[model samples]
Each structure stands twice: as C-alpha cells, then as structure tokens.
Target: MPRHVAIIMDGNGRWAKQRHLPRAMGHRRGVEAVREIVRAAGDMGLEALTLYAFSSENWKRPAQEVGDLMGLLKHFIVADIDEFVENGVRLKVIGRYRELAPDIVALIDDAVARTSENSRTTLAVALNYGAQDELVRATSAIAARVAEGSLAPADIDTDAFADALDTADMPPLDLLIRTSGEQRLSNFLLWQCAYAELWFTDTLWPDFSRAHFAQALAEYAARERRFGGR
Candidate 1:
C-alpha cells in the first residue's frame, strides 16, 4: 500500500454549474467527498493523506466565494471532528496558517490538537498552501539563521531544506492525484514529491467517489516506481 497519498481536489465550481446549482452547493458536496476519501484511505491502510484544500492563489477568487469557502471549512470542522476521532484518523494542517483569520486558525489548531493522538491514519489538509511560498519561507528562515550566526550556509542540503518545510513531520508523497480533468501540479509539494506517482482524472471533486479513488490506487499499483532507477 502507498504510504502517503496527496490529492489536488478540483472541479467543485464546475461540478455545481453542470447541475444548475450554486457553486456553494458544489463545495458543500465536495466536503462530503473529503469524508468519504478519508475513510476510504484509512480502510486501504494508507498512513498519510494530504489534500489540497485551498491554494495561496485561491485568494484571487471573488470575495463572496472565498467567504463561503472559509465558512464551509468551519462547518467541516464542527461536523468532522468527532468522526475523525471515531475513525482513528489524525487531523493535521500544512500551509501558511498565519495568514488565515484568527477564528479559522483557532479551529484548525483545535482540530489538530484534538486528533493528535489518533494512530490509524493521518489526514493532512493544505489550507492557504502553496509550494512556492513554502520554499520562500524556508529560505527566509535559513537566511535568518545564517544572519544570527546560528547556522552556516554550507550546512544546507536536501534534508535541511526538507526539515524547513511545513510538512517536515509528514512522510514524503508516494502518489499524487489531480481530479477534475486537470493535468498539472500547480505548485504543490515542490520539495516532497521527488518521486511520487501521478494520476489525473476527469472526475470532478463534488462527484469524486471512493471507486474513483480506488481506481487511482489500482493504477498506482501497476506502475514501476524506480525512483530514477533503470
């Protein structure tokens, strides 16, 4: 089984449009997909699951839509916290958390703290996350350390860079799935997905089911993960 599975959840708005429903409705339905996939991943013995919930660029969206997303996230916290614990799923967030509203940050912190002890599966949500920002932040941290005489520039290496990332505690990605017919990473996991298998599908986020997830896993199982080997 794959140790870590990362997903770029896309097509919520488009899915809603196709059904003549408001985009908020699609986002609401997409939340359910998150629940299903989290359980499906746990049942499949995956140790870590990382989801691209909101990107740094998502701020370009309209104000109302962004507000709705933030509100939906709060609702997700209220609804999923107990279920996360009941399912032995650990909740974690990796992103530029300081940029979020205080209330949302508090909710996320509470969720992370409450589920810290769960051992069966780990669910990591990437909120306000962007790979480029993570790299820039890490670089700034390294520069500060060097300026403080606390570290030497030559000491930096791949592991050093990895340690500086927000996802330092999580396992490296084994597989990356992008749904909604998208075929790009869009600047995710720049430092961690060194050798992850990639899967893309036309299935939109709101309509993404466990069967689609399973198909991605099945495809992953069929590949040769040489990690640059012959």
Candidate 2:
C-alpha cells in the first residue's frame, strides 16, 4: 500500500449545478465523500492522507460560497471528532491557520488535540494552503537562519528543505489523485509530489465513492515507480 496519498477534491459546485441544487448543497454532499475517503484510507492502512480541502486562491470565490465552505469545515470537524478519535485517526490541518476565523481555528486545534494520540492514520486537510505559498514560507525561514549565521547556505539540501514543510511529520507521498476530470495540480503539494503517481478521474467530489478510490490504488499497484532508475 502507498505510504501516503493526496487528493484534489473538485467539482462540488458543478455537481450541484447538474442536479439543479445550490452550490452549498454540493459542498455539503462533498463532506460525505470526505468521510468515506478518510475511512477507506485508514482501512487500507495508509500512513497519511492529505486532502486539498481549500487553496489560498479559493479566496477569490464569491463571499457567500466561501462562507458556506467555512461552515461545512466547522461542521465536519465538530460532528466527526468523536468518531475520528475512536477510530484512531489523527486530524491535522495544514496552511495559514492563523488567517482563519478564531472560532474555526479553535475547532481545528480541538480536533488535532483530541486525536493526537491516534496512530492508525493521519488525515491532513490542506485548508488555505497553496504549494507556492508553502515554498515561499519555507524559503523565508531558511533565509532567516542563513542571515543569522546559524546555518550555511551550502548546507541546505532536499531533505533539509523538506524538513521545513508543513508535511514534515507525514510520510512521503506516493500517490496523488484528482477528481472531476481536472488534469492539473492546481497549486497543491508541488514539492512533496515530485515522484508521486498521478491519477485523474471525471468523478465529482460528491459522487466519488470507495470503489473509485480502490480503483486508484489498484492502478497505483500496477505501475513501475523506478524513481529515475531503470
């Protein structure tokens, strides 16, 4: 099994539109998909599952839609905390967490704290996260250390830089799947996914099921990941 897997959950609004429902309804349904995928990942024995929950660029979306998304996030954490703790799933949110509303940040902290001891699987939600932004942040920290004469520029290497990433504690990423037929990274884990196998599907987030997830894993198992070696 892949040590770590990441997903770009797309097409929530489009799924809602196709059903003649409001965008918020699609987001609400997408939450159910999140729950299913989390359980499936844990059951499959994945060490970590990183989901592209919200990107920094998502701020450009309509205010009402953004508000609705935040509401769904809060509800997901609050309603699922007990189950997550019981199932040995560790909840973690990565990104500019301080940029979030105080209440939302508090809830995120609570969820993380509540399940910190669980070791079955780590579920990382990338909220307000962007790969470019993450790289910039890491670079800034490295530069600060260099300027302080605490670190030499020549000492920096791939592993050293990776240690500064938000996912430093997580396992190396092995598979990355994007739903809704979107064939792009959309500013997700650019650094971490350097060698991950990519899988894309037209299935929208709300319609994404355990079967679809299983298919991705099966396909991953068939590939030859040489990591640049023959």
Q: Compute each candidate's TM-score over C-alphas.
A: 0.96, 0.98
Worst-scoring 10-residue span by lDDT in model 1: 163-172
Candidate with top TM-score is 2
RMSD versus native structure for model 2: 0.8
Q: Give per-residue CA lDDT, model 1, range 12-96, as digits (tens).
A: 9999999999999999999999989999999999999999999999999999999999999999998889999898989989888
lDDT of 2: 0.95
Against the true structure, whose lDDT is highest? 2
Task: Tell me how far the alpha carbon of residue 12 in candidate 1 is from the true structure, in angstroms, after superposition.
Answer: 0.6
Against the unseen true structure, what C-alpha lDDT does each candidate score? Answer: 0.92, 0.95
lDDT string for model 2 (1-230, tens) is: 79999999999999999999999999999999999999999999999999999999999999999999999999999899999999999988889977999999999998999999999999999999999999999999888989999889999999889988999999999999999998999999999989999999999999999999999999999999998777
After TM-score superposition, the amount by which residue 215's alpha carbon in candidate 1 deviates from its true location, in angstroms, is 1.0
As a whole number from 0 to 100, the lDDT of residue 8 in candidate 2 is: 97
